[model samples]
Target: MEVYVELTYCMNGILFIMTYEMISLLLNINWSFLKILFLSFLSNISIVLIYIDYLPYISFLYWIVLFLFIFKKQFFLYFPVFLIVYFSILFFINTLIKESFIYNGILITPINYKDIVIVVMTCVFLIIETIYLIYAKRKIKPKDDLYDVTLIFNNKIYHLSGFLDSGNHANYLGYPLIFIKKSKIDTYQQLDTLIIDGLKKRKIDIILVDQVLVNKQSLRNVYIGVLDELDYDCLLNKELMGGII
Candidate 1:
C-alpha cells in the first residue's frame, strides 16, 4: 500500500495554517488570513518535496528556513506548545476511534486517517482559541461596574448593557449624544439624520434617538447614532457620564 502524496500535502498545508491561526488568536495578534494561507502553502512545499525525493535532511533545511522567515520569533518559541497540544488531542481521539490499518502485525496508516486527524485537531484548536479570546477580553473589565441602559422608544422599552466612554465627546448642536449599533435600534423612526464624508468620502448615517436612561438617570432629547462597530450594546457619551457615574 502506497501513501497518497497529494492528500498528505493538502492535509499538512491545512494543519500548518490552523496551527498558526490558533497561535495568533491566543496571542491577540492581528494577522491577515491571506498571509497565513501563503505561509502554510510555502512551508508545506518542503514536506511535499521530501515525500517525492526521499531526502529528509535537505527537506528539513528548507522547511526551517521558510518557517522562520514567515513567522516571528514568538511563533518559533511557542510552536512546540502547539504541537504538544495538537498531538495530545490526536492521541485522545485515536483511543476512541481506533481507526488503524494494520498489515503483518504492524499498524499502517490510511490517508483518510490523516484527513480525519486534521479536521479534529483544527476543531479542537478553534474551540480552545475562541474560549481563550473571550476570557482575555472579559478579564479587562469589571463585571459589577458595567451599566444597564434602557432605551424608551415608541412606548416600548429595550434594555441593554452600556459603558461610559470619555472618548465619546461628539455632540449635535450642543445636544449630548449616545452611541449604539444601528442594528440594535434601526427599527425606530429616526427624528433627524446627518451624513459625514470621511477622507475616503465614505458616507456614514448618524440617527437621533428620542430618549435613553442610564441606571435611572434620564437623558432627554439625546442623539443615538451608529458606530462602525461596538463591543458593548451601547456607549454613553462623556456629557452623560457625569450624570450616570
Candidate 2:
C-alpha cells in the first residue's frame, strides 16, 4: 500500500511575491543603500557556501550584522525589517527545495527546500549587481570632461555625463533643476508639488524626481529648474544640457 501526498499546502509554498516586500523589508539604510544590500546578500550566500554544514538561519544572521557594520548611520526602524526579510527568504527557500534529495515522497526534508533557495539566491544576485552599477556610475573616466555635462537620470539615480563645452560653461544663475526624464519618472505624485510650480514659473514643463532618489546635499528642498530653452516635452538632449544661455 502506497500513499501519495502533496505538501504544497504547507507554510512555505511556491507562490511568492519578491518585490512586494523589498522597500518594506529594508528600512532607512544609508550611505550606499544598494551597496549595503548587495554586500549583505553576497555575504549571506558566501557564509552558506563556505560553511556547508551550518544551519542557514544562524549563518544568515551573522552575514546581515557583518554587512550592517560596514554601512554607516543608524536606523533603529530597520531591525524588525531585517528579521522579516531574513525569515521570508528562509521560508520561501525551505518550501521549494525541502524534498528533492529525499526522493520517494516519504521523507519530506523541510531543510532541503531548493525552490526557495534558488529564488532567494536570485534576489541576492540582483542586489549585488546593483552595487556594481552604483560603483561604476561614480567612477569618472579620463575621457569624461567635468565642466559641461548632461545629468542622465536612470534607475532612480543620476549619472552626470555628456561633455560641457568650455565656451558654454556659464552656470545658469538660478536653482538647478532636478530633472526627471519621462523614462525615469514613474509616479508623478511622489514628487513635491513645488516642482510643478517651478515649471510654471520658469515657463518650462514641470520635471520633478522622487525625493528618495536624491542624496542629501546643501539643498533643503530639491527644487525643479526647468531649462527655459529645452523642450520640456522630451528629456533635455545632452547637447543642450551641457550649457546655459
Candidate 3:
C-alpha cells in the first residue's frame, strides 16, 4: 500500500496538538489553544525528521527538548507523565483499530487506510479524555463565584444556587440581606411592606430568616428578601461572605 506522506504529516500535526491539550488539562496546566497549536506544529517537525530517518526513540528525545525549552517553569517530571497519558491512549486506540480490521478478515497490508486509522483513533481518545476532564471538574469544588446553598425561612427549607454579589452590600440595621427570586417563594409580602420600603430607601430590611447554610457553614438571623430580576436563585448576603470567600 502506498502511504501519502503530506497527508500523514498534516494528520499527525492535528492529532499531536489535540493530544497536547488533553495532557495539559490532565496536568492542570492551562494553555491557550494557539500556544499549544504552535508548539504542536513545531513538534511535528520531529515526526517528519523521524519518518525520514526511520529512527526509533527519536520522538522521545525531541519531545524532551521541546518540553524543556517551552515549559521551563513547570516541573520536569510532568513531561514523562504527559507522554505516558498521551501515548497510552494513542497506542490503545491504534491497536483497537488494527484489531478491528484483522477481525473482519481485512488485509491491513493491502489497504491504504493508515491516515484514516490515525485520525479516527485520535478523535476517539480526545473525546474520552475531554469527558473524563469534565466529570473531574464537577466532582471537584468549583472555582467560580457561585456555590450551592440551603436556606431555612419560617421553618420551611429551600435549596438554592447562590451567586456571590460583591456589589450587594445591603444590610438591614446590621443584618445581612440574602436576596431570593420573587417567583421562587409562593408566599408574597411575607414581611411587612414597611420593611421592603425601608430596604429600597435606606438599604435596610426588617425581614429576618432563621438560617443560611453554605459551604458547610451556618449563618443565623440573615434577612431574606425577594427581587424581580436576578441571575441566580439566591444572592448571598455580604455579611455571610466570609464563609465562602
Candidate 4:
C-alpha cells in the first residue's frame, strides 16, 4: 500500500508538470522548467488528501484552489486544457491500454507498459506545442532585436513583445523613454500628460509604472510613453541595454 501511494505521488507529479508545460506553451507564457517543476511539486502535495476519508472530493478542490492562485485570471484558460489532457490520458489508458489498473484514482501497477502511455502522450503533446511555438515565434518575432517585456502598472501585469530601436533616444529629464501603443495604457485614468517637440509638438500620456522588465532585467519606476500608433507593442530604447538613462 505504501509503495502504491508513492508510485501514485510520482505519477501525479509528472502529470502535473507536463500539463502545466502544455498550458504555458498554448498561452505563449515563458515559464522556466524549474518553475514548472516547483509548482508541480507543490501540486503533488495535494495528493496526500487522497488518504483521507473524503478521497477525491477535497483533493480535487484543493487542486483547483492551487491552480487559481497560481494562474489567477488565466485559470479559466488553463483549467479546460488540463481537464482535456488529464481525461484523455485516463480514457486512453482505460480503453486502449488495459494492462494496468487504477484503484481509488491511483495507479497501483508496478512500473510497466502503463507508464509508457504517459511518456508517449507527453512527448506527442510537447512536440506539437513545440512546433506551434516555433512557428508562432518566427511569425511574430521576425527580428533578433525583439525582446520579451513585462510591465506592472495600476496593480496589473502586462506582458508585451518589444522591438529594440537605436533611433528611439527620447528621454524626459534624464529618464529614459520607451514607447507603447496608446490602447495598451489608455485605459489607465491616472496618467500624467507631457508635451514633447518633434516634427510638430504633440501631447502624449505618460505614466511611471511600478516596474518594467526588459528581457527580464528589472527597471524600477520606469516611465512609459503612450503613442497613438506603433508597429510593435513596445519600442525599446537602446540605452536600456546598459542601464536607465
Best of the candidates, lDDT: 4
lDDT of each: 0.60, 0.37, 0.63, 0.70
Model 4 TM-score, all chains together? 0.51
Q: Could you tell me how far off, in angstroms, the CA of residue 231 lies in candidate 2 after the best superposition?
A: 25
Candidate 3 worst ten-residue window by lDDT: 101-110
lDDT of 4 by residue, 85-202 (tens): 6556545544543455554443443456656676567557656765665576568655887888888988898899888888989886698888888776537753678876653355
List ranges where model 1 is wrong by over 4 Å. Answer: 1-134, 141-145, 191-204
Error of 2 at 158 (Å): 18
Pitting candidate 2 against candidate 3, the one with the higher TM-score is 3
Using all chains and alpha carbons, the TM-scores for the candidates as numbered come to 0.48, 0.29, 0.44, 0.51
For 1-245, candidate 2 gives per-residue lDDT tens digits of 22123332222222112321343334422224544445444443432232345444454455456546653233234444545664565555545554433211112234334644664665575556555544553552324443222232233443432233334322222434433334433433333233223212333344443332212222223334344343222222233343232
Candidate 2 vs candidate 4, TM-score winner: 4
Best by TM-score: 4
lDDT of 1 at 78: 54
Report the error of model 2 at residue 28, Å: 7.7
Clashing pairs in 1: none
Report the Cα lDDT for residue 117, model 3.
Answer: 68
**115: Cα error in model 4, Å:** 5.8
Q: Rank candidates by TM-score, best first.
A: 4, 1, 3, 2
Pairs with backbone N, CA or C atoms under 3 Å apart (clashes), candidate 4: none
Which portions of model 4 miss their true places by more than 4 Å? 1-3, 93-99, 102-108, 111-142, 145-245
